[model samples]
Target: MVFDIGIVSNKKILLVDDEEDIVNLLETVLRKEGFKNIIKAKNGIESIELCKREKPDLIVLDIMLPDIDGFLVCQEIRKFSTSPILFLSAKDEETDKILGLGIGGDDYVTKPFSPKEVAYRIKAYFRRHQIGSGKQTSYSIGNLSINEETGEVYKNRNHVILTAKEFQLLLMFCKNPNRILSKNLLYEAIWKEDYLSNENTVMVHIRHLREKIEDTPSKPKFIRTVRGLGYKLVTQENI
Candidate 1:
């Protein structure tokens, strides 16, 4: 299967893995898919340094590195950059996937995986970002107003900063006010993939999301838990 995702063709990609063969293979595959500016790193420390130096558009990171592991690398990168991160790991456990996503990874691929799938995922990230760029759509409930195209949230007339994922999640809720959105639905819509059995993946992101937009994160007003079902967003006018 070939993807001609031109929006990501010229984008820079950073590949981090201890294995030389995996790095070589991914580089070749990504290049074949039209990605030109590709860089490689062998350890977590080097990867971090490269991220700071290169500021690549996308990152393909291995979970286990020779020095600091990919999770820490992700954590450190999130501090300075919001570039989309894809985790490549040999461990296929649910806990690992949850941990990776919880820390702000955009996607996770278990090892013995297809390189073409990884390339497609990278293209998907760029496509999503393009969709989010430079448009105007408004969602206002009480004092909270979100501008989807601009990726801005104003709470109580004050600006709020959110991660890329959080903004998308909130936009999903805003578009479907008062509708019950199940975890599976939310996962597929936002992540653009099938829902794995990791409930905490969505849960943690929602928790972090509430912390930013809710008056009281502990007792939320806008995004409400639906007890045994899922989650819904409520507006004062709707009530």
Candidate 2:
């Protein structure tokens, strides 16, 4: 059977962050957006384990956590899942937002943000699945396999846990390997405009990803930088 271009309802979403007020507020917001099944986690560690079990369709993550930072959580979750991740945090710095995106966040929103806007952005993403037919499929390069349907990645056939955003970044690279993805292009693709700038997000996520998939992050083999250009994934040559 062919899958749709986007994912639609009845699926659950895992909401993770260290703040109670934010969690509760988002839970309510998600419900208002027609996300009936929602799960919550207070910190990065809890988010990781929760993802291993519940397997929500998407994730709402925070950058600052009690145990691990959200970026690492994004890395950890990317290990085994591809659920869409949207960041909600007070760390509105350009670097912080880019870190979330470059690591693979689908979207980023700073705290004191508009809940209505966030909800609207999410619905737009989900709409992709609701529209297209034949479904965007999955593929692999060497030991790394991507299941476009589930948005999950595997290394040596072992599920690599990743936050929703990390999965998105990886997916973008996988789809357009060997193409130099400029920082601006990446920022636009991941986080909708009106919320991005030159910073450490892409660099951080690329570093984090290198740590995971690269045999040697210092000498990356999969995702490579073009120095003056951007980043590209190598099908054969090392980065």
Candidate 3:
């Protein structure tokens, strides 16, 4: 059976790491996965400049770059683009992961991760972002409007800019309204893998998503936490 993998089928990827071996390995893996345009950068400065010049679809960045570090790199890139960023780091601490995600990163992978796993995560990101393509469906909750066909969200008639992951989370909530979606379920569905103790990862993304879509993120109405259970999107029918 043939399938159409939109958006990502011909994405240009930017791979940034100081280690040549890691870059080579990821390059090989992405190539085998059928990615055509892959660009490489060795240090933080080069990565930043290359990102501006190339404007790749996604970026795989290492945190321990020789110059400025991946966190700083992500901050810089966010100034110009909202391209999806996946951090590659040896820092596996929960704080590190939270900090990375807090700083506009779409995802993070600790060091010693399977190259295949990284490839899969990237593919999942692309898949979720492409879910709305070729569809004219729109969903509304309160004052917010989501146009799936154009991949756009609006609050009070103003456009809301969201990272790719945030948009995906919102879409998921729209599709499964009134159901308590556990963190593990969300992680697996969106990231295409089993949850690996990344609960805080989901929290960070959810918080960000709420901030964009809610009148008051601190007292969110659209996305409500079920405490011990998980989260659910409460539309007008449930309200």
Candidate 4:
């Protein structure tokens, strides 16, 4: 996919991996793809420090690092920044994928991946952010309010912090209220990938979103499961 080079060049990208060769290869590819402001970190501690200092627009992280694993690094980073994190790891286990996404990762690309594909994914994420930013709409359902322009969410006038993916999920529901969103549809839409019958990814994110926005996640009032159908965000009128 061709990206607007002028826009892409300005976004700062952080590449974190203990392997020197992997980091170099990714940096080369990203630079070739018009990403100019690339930062490199070889370990989890350095990655964390750079993340705090640089405040990158996105991060490509590897799970197995020298100081701490990528999962812990991701947890720490999520406490402050909502920048998109793409996990690049050799661990292809389903549990690891779930854990990565559950802890606040936006995408997971296993090792032995194509550099061009990774570059394309990064471009796609930036494109999504651009499109999302162009929106100035705000919606309020019950006590929850979302400002798409600022990417801010509020619950009962109290500020609610959300991961980037979680906020996108809520925004998707808010856009299509009272409509059933099947797991496959949601997986395709939010993950920006084909649905591989991996329902857990969507389920985990939805559970997390409920925890943040619902009065009682156990008996969710807004995002309700339609059992065999899928899930729906119940509007105020429906409630």
Candidate 5:
């Protein structure tokens, strides 16, 4: 049971896939759902360019691409933007799915998936971010601002360009603030129902995010490694 009752009509989405049929079908489905701004990129390289130009609210990315693999593209995308990423790959392995999420994707939709199901999940994700007389998506720590609705993040009134995965990782930290989030916790939250996974996926994104937002990534102020505990976000110095 999904409803777009409070949703804005002009939402934007980026659909990235090498397969034309899949892109066309998903584009059609998104158009029918009231997303007026739907952009398309056939491969990972093109996807990066589209991201720089359009800055879509969400992205539908395939795991496999003709030029570059989806994971690598995801890593690179994490460098500049933090939009929500939903893997649209055909690989159905638990490890793969987990790996995608762990890297920066908010959700994973297997190939041959129902358009309606994808729509439903998208709706749910949107609802989760809507700030009204309901669940609020905006989060802040010190000068950082995170909008869960659009998956947009900012710091000190400045738009912090974070890759989709970096944004995801930031959101998890901001929500908990001082809680020491274990690597496993992070890995699982991003990649629900993993189809494949490797430890490097999470490590790479973490390093990238630190470089972008931290005053001294080597000596982080916002996101800190808790030695044996993992990572946490704190506004003030640990006393």
Candidate 6:
């Protein structure tokens, strides 16, 4: 898990948490990992303001804030930036995790989490972005078109806004058109972690992705369920 210090030092990270100890711990770990440009916010308002002003590359957000919860903050931020957001919340409930991911979070880590693990997650995200870059490619299926180079998605020529994770999911599907993708395969591929009965996590992300790319999520025309198997993206050839 060695990262390029020069690259890591240049990437700005925003940490939003009212808890001083939590913020300090994350900052310490990130700094030790060679991330030099780090910003901190104590409330949702400050976080939003910092996000606009600083334009961070990634954000570590907390659910419980002084004013406006992290969910609302994420919604507001989504209006402007597609920067990856990782939720760091004390609530470990499945519902909270689903809501966080559905709203736009790229990852979620419950409180009492290891500082080192959080650092590693941040590095993993940056690494994925680096690997995904340098590819000047575009794919089109039906009315859906994706530009991998620009990370832009369009449906019937209308621009579509997608969360980071959602974009990755659709890109994966596009690369494997007409092929059924199992939940375990997707979870491991996108999350970069072993699957541990995290079907709901993959399901929620796919549902959100479908809402953006499908004409009707309830009766999806593109990304369809394979009943007992998995999900597949239907291309023009398949259609």
Over 93-211, each residue of candidate 6 has an lDDT whose tens digit, in order, gives 99999899988999999888999999999988887777433658899888888998888999999999898898889989989989999999999999888999889988998998888
Off by more than 4 A, model 5: 1-8, 133-239
**C-alpha lDDT of residue 226 in model 3:** 95
| lDDT (Cα, tens digit) per residue for candidate 4, span 1-239 | 34466889999999999889988999999999999999999999999999999999999999999889999999999888888899999978999999999988989999899999999999988877775336589999999999988889999999887888999999999999999999999988888889987899999999988988999999998999999989999986542
Task: Write candidate 3's Cα lDDT for 1-239 as tens digits.
Answer: 22345455589999999899999999999888878789999998998899889899899999999989899999898767778999998977889989988778988899899999999888867765564336588899889898777778889999887776777788889999888999998987776668988788789889988887888899998999999888999986542
Report each candidate's C-alpha RMSD, comma-separated, in the order given: 3.1, 4.6, 3.0, 1.9, 4.9, 1.9
lDDT of 2 by residue, 63-178 (tens): 88898888899878876776888888787687676667777676788888876777677777676445345486887887788887765678898777665545667888988978
Q: Which stretches of candidate 1 lie over 4 Å from their true place?
A: 1-4, 132-134, 140-145, 152-161, 196-198, 237-239
Show model 4 residue runs off by greater than 4 Å: 1-3, 132-135, 237-239
TM-score of each: 0.84, 0.70, 0.82, 0.93, 0.65, 0.93
Q: Which residue pairs in candidate 4 collide?
A: none
Overall lDDT per candidate, in order of appearance: 0.85, 0.75, 0.85, 0.91, 0.76, 0.90
- Tens digits of per-residue lDDT for model 5, 88-165: 888888778767766667677888899878876666666655555545568877777788776666767887777555
Q: How close is candidate 5 to the true structure, as a TM-score?
A: 0.65
Count of backbone collisions within predicted model 1 = 0
Index of the highest-lDDT prediction:
4
Local error of candidate 4 at 144, Å?
1.4
For every model in order, what is the number of clashing pairs? 0, 22, 0, 0, 18, 0
Model 3 poorest ten-residue lDDT run:
1-10
Compute the lDDT of residue 33 as modeled in candidate 6.
94
By lDDT, highest first, what's the ranking?
4, 6, 1, 3, 5, 2
